[model samples]
Target: MVDRLEQSKALASDVRLTILTWLKTPALHFPHQVTGDPAEIGVCVTLLADTLRISQPTVSRHLEVLRRAGFLRVRRIGRWSFFARDEITLSDYAEWLRDTL
Candidate 1:
């Protein structure tokens, strides 16, 4: 489990939050993928980079933050990496926040 401080740091950025929000409904936020289903394969890093208008490496860094926070689930296909939100973790985090507050 990630410590509260690290989790807080991970979520403290607007980019990370937006990435999380976009993952909630990837089909709506991302264009149709040629090889894989968004729901099954998760959103591609290329799509995220295009959507954010940032370099792929930058998007990767943001994704790393969320991953470390336990907010994302990842799948690697060949050279590509796909990401999806870990809803269960988010739910637990939400509950923790509610109880803490």
Candidate 2:
């Protein structure tokens, strides 16, 4: 089983939570990419960094935390990595939370 403490730690950060919320409606919050499909491949790291008004490395670090927690999914297409919410994982976490609490 996944560690509850780890999950809580991942969600505890405001930046991470914001990333999750922005990912929910990527089309609305993020701009269109020149190459990839936002709806399909997910939002690009550069776009996310720009939208968040933070450095690319900083955004990447936050994304990594979410990814590790199973809250986000990553797709490596060519040079850039795209991020999207893992619906199944989120659902399972929600169910786990309900039972645990």
> Can you tell me which runs of candidate 1 are displaced by over 4 Å?
none
Count of steric clashes across candidates, in order = 0, 0
Model 1, residue 91: C-alpha shift (Å): 0.5
Which model scores highest in TM-score? 1
**Model 2: residues with Cα > 4 Å off, grouped in runs:** none
Q: Residues 13-83, candidate 1: write the lDDT tens digits.
A: 99999999989998888757765888788999999999999999999999998998899989999999999
Cα displacement (Å) at residue 61, model 2: 0.7
- What lDDT would each prediction earn against the true structure? 0.89, 0.88
Question: How far in Å is the alpha carbon of 75 misplaced in model 1?
Answer: 0.2
Total backbone collisions, model 2 = 0
Query: Candidate 1 has what TM-score?
Result: 0.94
Q: What's model 1's lDDT at 96?
A: 89
Q: Which candidate has the highest lDDT of all?
A: 1
